[model samples]
Target: MKQLLLEIDETTEAKINAAAKTAGLSAQQWLQQIIDEKTVTTWPNAIKALAGTWQDAPFSEELRAAEGQDISREDF
Candidate 1:
């Protein structure tokens, strides 16, 4: 694990401590959670769990596929 050093005013530190205490987490854990949430790039577990649960879900090609000839475009 990497370590970080931050400089904060006493008031900010106090606020962080109070919020972390209310959340039942150490300051480090609370900050880590916030960082993780902000950095997420993919679906969270709750959303990923929904995969394969829908029946007859349309695939991308099925939705975008066109069957007829293209319509003519007028002169620009």
Candidate 2:
């Protein structure tokens, strides 16, 4: 694990402490969680779950099938 040194003002430090307490984690753990959440590379599960949900959605091929014709027939 790498160590990070941050210089924060008193107000920011207090806010971080309060947030960490509320989350039942140490300040370091809260910061680590935030870093992990921000650095994620893939779609979250909630978004991935929406895949293929539109029953009548058009594919890329379908969209190009008839250019200039609007996708009005597309369900969603």
Clashes of each: 0, 0
Query: Best by lDDT, which number?
Result: 2
Runs of candidate 1 with Cα error greater than 4 angstroms are 49-76
- Residue 38, model 1: Cα distance from true site in angstroms: 0.8
Q: Model 2: per-residue lDDT, tens digit, 1-76? A: 8888999999999999999999999999999999999999999999999998879867898878767666457577
Worst 10 residues of 2 by lDDT: 66-75
**In model 2, how large is the Cα lDDT of residue 13?**
98
Return the lDDT, model 1, position 44.
Answer: 88
Give TM-scores for every candidate, taking all chains together and pairing residue i with residue i. Answer: 0.58, 0.65
Give per-residue CA lDDT, model 1, range 46-74, as digits (tens). 99999889898789778768765568999
Give RMSD (Å) of candidate 1 vs. truth: 6.2
Model 2, residue 15: C-alpha shift (Å): 0.8
What lDDT would each prediction earn against the true structure? 0.91, 0.92
Best by TM-score: 2
**Candidate 1 displacement at residue 54 in angstroms:** 9.5
Q: How accurate locally is residue 71 in candidate 1, as Cα lDDT from 0 to 100?
A: 84
